[model samples]
Target chain A: MSRHQVRVLVVLALAAYPALYHLLTQSPVGVEAETLLPRMDTMVALLYFGLFAVSFDFISGYTGYLSFGHAAFYGTGAYFVVLVANGKIPLVPSGTPFMITLLCAGLVAALLAVGIGLVSFRLSGVYFAMITLGFAQVLYVFVRGLEWISSNPRDGASVSGSTHPEGFEVGVPFVDGLNLAIGPLSGDTVTLLGHTLGTNAVSFYLVGAVVLACYLAMQRIIHSPFGQVMVAIRDNEERAEAIGYDTFRYKMGAFVTSGFFAGVAGGLFAGFRRSVTPENTFYFLVTGDALLASIIGGFGTLAGPIFGHFFDESIREFLSPAGQGGGLLPYLQTRLSEGVLSAEVGGLTVEGFIEAALNGHASLYVGIVFVLFVLYVPNGLVGAARDRLGGPVTEKLPDRLWDR
Target chain B: MTAVADPALADAGLALADATPGSVFAASVLQTGFFAGLAEFLRPSNLAGVLVNGLAKSALFVMIAAGLSLIFGLLGVLNFAHGSLTMIGAYLGGLVMVVLVGGATGAWARLGYFLVALVVVFAALAVLGLVVEVGLIRQLYDSPPIYQILLTFGVTLVLEELVRIVVSFYGLQPISDWQEALGTKPAFLARQTTLGPVTVRGLALFEILLGALTVVGIWLFLTRTRYGLFIRAGSEDDEMAAALGIDVRRVFTVVFALGSALAGIAGALLMWDPVWGASVPLAAETLLPAFVVVIIGGLGTFRGTVVGAVIVGMADAVTTWWFVNVVTWTWLPEVTVFLILVGMLVVRPQGLYGVEEVGGH
Candidate 1:
């Protein structure tokens, strides 16, 4: 298949996932499928967060400038949306459309990126990362202590019932028919083609649409001449400068562009969750999560982080304790006989062993995988796959398979 | 917002101010204005207290950052897992103290036990450092410096989670300070000591003494010992040092071990302090401040780390005092530290004692 065909195929597969999950979980072997596949709600989270990761990759991966304080932009975007909706921000009314709020969020984040980048891009490597982190941390602490954000700013601000009782809408601004409200509690349900989609499914599709739009926009930039300069800057910045490319300007541009998208992702997150917290949005760990996704997916590949996050979230859900999402522990409990479960081994029963080893300990296993990935699979999943295929998946895979 | 204009507002403000020790002055700053507040804050007692607090904080900062600076100097790897090592030390030290101390144990005996705990934690953490350096960090020596950071970050996640699991299993709250461990402190260290016009925590004096001893010990080791000379030589130019028949790789391992040992010792010290006790979040809390200190001092320079720690510690102290006495913002202290870092980077990216092209390598 051609590159475009491959791209289309991937999108089709992603589009079909929720439907496939729904059908598979209802089938005879539904329990097994449920144990493995991520739920619709998790997918919704993955879409927005995955967008953030992709934006992270756009700068750090493509240009070799690790924006360690990338969470600042994300937090700014998230806070802006929530604050605007609550009518806490100046000029922007509470009843303003969500789409406009999201746009403003992105623009504000981009402006922040420009301010940070002017100072940061002067340095390289660790210094750049540290400076950006310092800026973000300052913002994080400042936001956490702001009394006007809410009665308790440390816990973060929520979409107040007095202002935004209905869920934040996703679609054309000021058009009720086109826009779909998204939240677990307040989201809209839809019926089409004899299949009823629940709130989560509707949210999944709407959020996915926004994520797809961002991805396509970013992908276009990556394939442009501007992207070539970014890659050049990454490979040999001195050489790029020697060639009179004005590498600093390109770097700033890339940083601002990525910051904008990250903001959009954060805005989507606020819209869906209807709440914003400094810990979740502005914390260094938030940036770390994006870094993890970028690394696991394929550092330089624009589309890779989405898949990487999917893999990560799946693992987390799989190892998560029973009840919330189907996991190994819950699956084993129902499937294993009582005698086997109680069988003693190394001073603990089989059930006890599983509980001790795997229950609520997804981070341990995820961390191990991350370590292994860093050590061996340094190129990450998509990068390794591309390496194996001897070219980009889109361009080379079909040629290799057809022996052309 | 106008405190003097409205009686109810004034009363509420006064009540809020009276709720905390230094807030009366803060309320006065609001009621009486900035100059009067400054006059009240300039009192000898307050100044002396802040100075003492700053020194004690600087001592702790130096202890935590010294190891990180040492490893970065030689290996050019910013060990992200350094904080986790410190955290493990806290728990390990706490474990020793809790196990050794009894209700009948005297203050001197408790102090003696703490010394033993420090030694034990240092040794154990040193071995861990050795294992990690030889096993995980060694593999990524040839990759980009970013990979080294990534690898250590992965290590941090694993270590924290493992600690969490064990802590939870032992029926301890991983998020809060281990109160049982706090209860193991010697009575003398927990009490206040008056010196001339100023009164300070007994623990602060002990910490200052320990801090001084640590500085003297490390200084002697770095300046006087053959291994320290080797480390210095290696840090300057490893290939040249290797060509001179020095085992650079072994030096790297030694530095990594030493750094981890230092972090562990710091953790042991923190376990006794009430403000920063043995907790899971302590890793990030200490790690960030350590980073700020190292960066402000210059990434890998010991002298720079010391200077950086003092600067940050002083800033933290001043901001904290202001938060208590002059400002109502709760995050002022924390925010100031990061602001200083950002300001430092903008002003001098190379840090106080850092070379022009340190991180470039």
Candidate 2:
């Protein structure tokens, strides 16, 4: 198969996921599939958040400048979208199309990146991370206290019923026929052929489309000559400078571009969820999640973080407290005999042990996996795959298999 | 200054302030303005209160940040799990206090038990630190500095989740202050005492005392002991220290243990304070400020940490005062702390005493 064939295959697989999930969950093997696979709603979250993580990797992994305050851009994008919809922002009408707001969010975040990069790019390594973090934290605190955003800003702002109550759309700015509203309840549903897609399924496709676009854009940049300089700067800043490349401008450009996509991701999040909080959007741990995704997926790979987040969200859903996605505890409860569950070990019943060890404790397992990856799988999943292929996977894998 | 010293001048100043504005003007601007707040802040009583509060905060800052600074100085690894370790210390300290202290126990005996709790927490966390350093951190010594950070960050996730499980299993709210632990505090420490014009919490005074003692103890360890000399030497140039036949690796292990021990002790202290009681989220809350303090002081310098703590503590106290009395913005104090960090980085990226290339490594 060719590289383009592989690309097409991947996109087709992603596009088919919701339909496949629907089909598999209702088949004779439904129970097993339901127990293992992530729910459609979780997949929707995975798409936008995966985009944020990919953007994080774009600058941090590619340029070797960890944008530790990357959440600031995400939070700005989210807040801008919500605020504009609520008519809180000046000049921009609340009736402004959702796509326009999202684009504006990206632009605003890109502008913010320029402002932050001006000061931040002066420092490198840990100092750069710390300064960016400081700036984000400053914004985080400011937003949390600003009553102008809401009656209770600490709780965050929501898309109010007074304005834009139908939900944010995710297509062309003015074309209603092309646009699809995205939310759990407020979203639009579609019936295609004999299959009827629910709100969540529709949202999954729409959000996935946006994420795919962002990914392709980032992938193009990574494969460009500009991206070569970014990698060069990461590998050796002095050498890049010696070769007459103005490393700082390239760094700033990369930062702004990543910031734009991160903002878009945030806007998508706000559009789907219809609410934004400082804790979820601007907090340092949000950046940590992106970092985790980048590390697990393959730090420098453009498409790696998405797969990384898929792994993350799957684990989280599998160990979720309520077992909303049919997790291990529920699966065990259905599979285990009464006597086996009641059997005692280490002063606790078998059921009790599982509850104590596995239930709602996905973070523990995820953390362990992350540590192991850092230690043994330092190159990450995609990077390791590339290593096995003896070069970039897209270019080398095809040659190894077909050309030979 | 004159208004603070002389009653007549103060009265005259008040009269002039009262005469200057309409009631509407006073309500809208003068009552909430910076100048009015500044005048009130300058009063001797308010000054004294803020001073004590600032000192207490500085003490806590110093205690939390000292270990982080020390470990980074030698290992060049910013221990992200330090705050989680401190959180564990709070719980362990609280556990010791809750188990040992009874309703009938006197304040002096409670104080003694608190000391015992501190020692127990320090020892336990030191052992844990030893295990982590030897098992996890040691393996990443060959990798880039970022790996160590990533490793410690993973450790934080595991530690916090484990704590959450235990805390919840024990029928306690992991997010809120553990009231049972707060109940273990001695009566004297829980109450307020007036010193002339200033009123201060007994816990604040105790914190200041413990903080000073900790500072003095670490200072003596660094300046007077052979191990301290080795640590200082190792921090400067570990390769050179190794060439001189000093066990640099052993020094790293020891400093890591010591740093963890300091975090534990700080957590134990925080457990007794009402403002920051034993809680899971305390890890991030304490961690961020500790980061700011360390960064503002320069990443790995002890003296700079102390100076940075004082600056941050004073700023926090002042902002808090303004929030309570002058400004209605609830995030003023918290925002000011981060702003200081940003301002400091822009002005002097190396920090007060940091070498320019310290973070580069």
Candidate 3:
């Protein structure tokens, strides 16, 4: 398929996800779809992460400058949005519009990127990587000490008007009709297309739309002429400089762009999570998640990390405990106990094996898969597919993954 | 290590060495105002405690950093999983110690068991090192340097999760028991020995001695042994060394194993000393500091690693001692280390002992 076709297909699919998920989850006869289909809230959360990873891919993937402290922008955005929305910031009063707060969050993150990039861009390679990490840690400590933001410094402030107190009600953008009543808001049901949808189901569509918009914007940036310069710098900085490209300025631009999108994702995350802590917001490991997603999806492919994150979250959902409901492991365990697989292998059932593997070591499998991927499949899932097909059919997508 | 690496560093080291404690202290007060409130904040007893504590901390950093430096110098890979290896060693060592001495009758018997367990842990890590090199690392030597980092990172994740899974599955009580015993201030390591006005724990002194011994052992091996020559030569010019009828590949394997073993010993000592008790997060937490030490000291240089460790370790100790007492800024300790790390990178990106690589320095 051509690049345009694939992008259109992806956007259409994302747009249809809520309806498809709703329908697919509904099982035959008496079986409830709730168990089989992930909860709407879960889907929304996955979309948030998908967006986050996609933004991460925009800079690190294109420029090959692995920002180990990317979470600094993420936390800044999350904290800013939540604080502004909750009337914590003096200038930004309480009940500020969510979209405005979100935009402001992105702007703040971009400003932060400029300051950090100016100092850190001087170092290259591993030194650059460590310095970014150090910068993030400094931010992490700073937020952890601010007790006024939240009553507890360690556990940071939450959106006061979130789902808990009904201090705010989220509705369709620009539409006067009351939508998903969150926190202590309103009625549980939202009527759409002659069907009454739960608040979570409405939330899924709302967040999904935002995520789709962000992804498209990032995709546009990735294909722009400026992005090409960023890629050139990644491949060879000296050559880029020799060509009179002003590689440093181009890199700074890419960094700011990446930060802005990452901040948007952070704003969405705050909305979904309703709370933000230093550990959850600014931790270095959060950047690792984006890196992991980019690697798993395909570095330098703008949309690959989004797909990677979705795949990751789905797998995690499948293996999670029974209380979550509809977990594949629990279902497998039940089936194995009733079937012949339980009797084989000297009495240790397939269920036991699965249990053993999933017993707090799910990440081990991810690590093993990562190593194997690096060794055997450097291009990741998307790149390998592209290569096998002899590259993208789209003229817009060059033979290379990074090429627009 | 090699003609003093950088003369400026050598001069600074010598000058600092030549300065008397009183003079240095007075200068610090005058110049940086670093010791302005020292009289109010630190008593004689507190000073002794911080010094002894700092020495022990430096010892730990040195042990971990030395192995990391050796591997990076020889293999040209950062070995992100180095901390995980140490973590594994600590867990294994802790388990063996508990099994061997958990049932021992007397203090002497327990001491013997502990010693035996440490040796066992070292050997185990060496064997693990061999397996990792032969099976995984060897294939990636020709790949991009990032592959090595990613590979080691994956290995670290796998090992960390594996440790967690194994402990949960096997109901590994020794792991938790060791933590608990250490938390309660175990009788075995509770006693302190007073030397000249400074009271120091026997375990701390032993760890310090071990650190010193590792330095000497590694220095001798590097300077006097044939294998060490191969390692040094390989690091400098692998192709050239290979052309000269030397099995550079075998040298890499040996050096990697030895480095891993050294990390294992450090991990085992940490378990006994209860410094950040062995846990799943140990691998993740120890990684940055080790990276900082290697970078600050100069990549692949033992002397640089030692210097970096001291710089980091003493900064941590002094910051903790001062901030915890005077301002109660618990967060300053981490900030101090980060400041040093950033300052070093901005001033000397090649590190104190390293030659230039990326050209900034």
DockQ metric for all predictions: 0.52, 0.47, 0.30
Q: How close is candidate 3 to the true structure, as a TM-score?
A: 0.88
**lDDT by residue for model 3 over A31-88, one digit each (tens)?**
3344355656667777777777887878777887778889999999889877876677
RMSDs, each prediction? 4.1, 4.5, 7.5
Runs of candidate 1 with Cα error greater than 4 angstroms are: A402-404, B1-29
Best model number under TM-score:
1
Categorize the docking of model 1.
medium
Candidate 3 lDDT at B242 equals 98
Interface RMSD of each: 3.2, 4.1, 7.2
- Model 1 scores a C-alpha lDDT of 0.88
Q: Tens-digit lDDT track for model 1 on B297-359?
A: 998788899999899888887666655555667777888898888888888998999887677
Cα deviation at B247, candidate 1, in Å, is 0.4
Error of 3 at A259 (Å): 1.4
* Cα error of candidate 2 at position A145, Å: 0.9
TM-scores, in order shown? 0.96, 0.95, 0.88
When candidate 2 is compared with the true two-chain complex, its DockQ is 0.47
Report how large a share of the reference interface contacts model 3 reproduces.
0.49
Cα lDDT, model 1, residue B62 = 95
Query: Residues B287-356, candidate 2, lDDT per residue (tens digit)?
Result: 8889899999998788889999999988888777665555556667888898899888888988998877
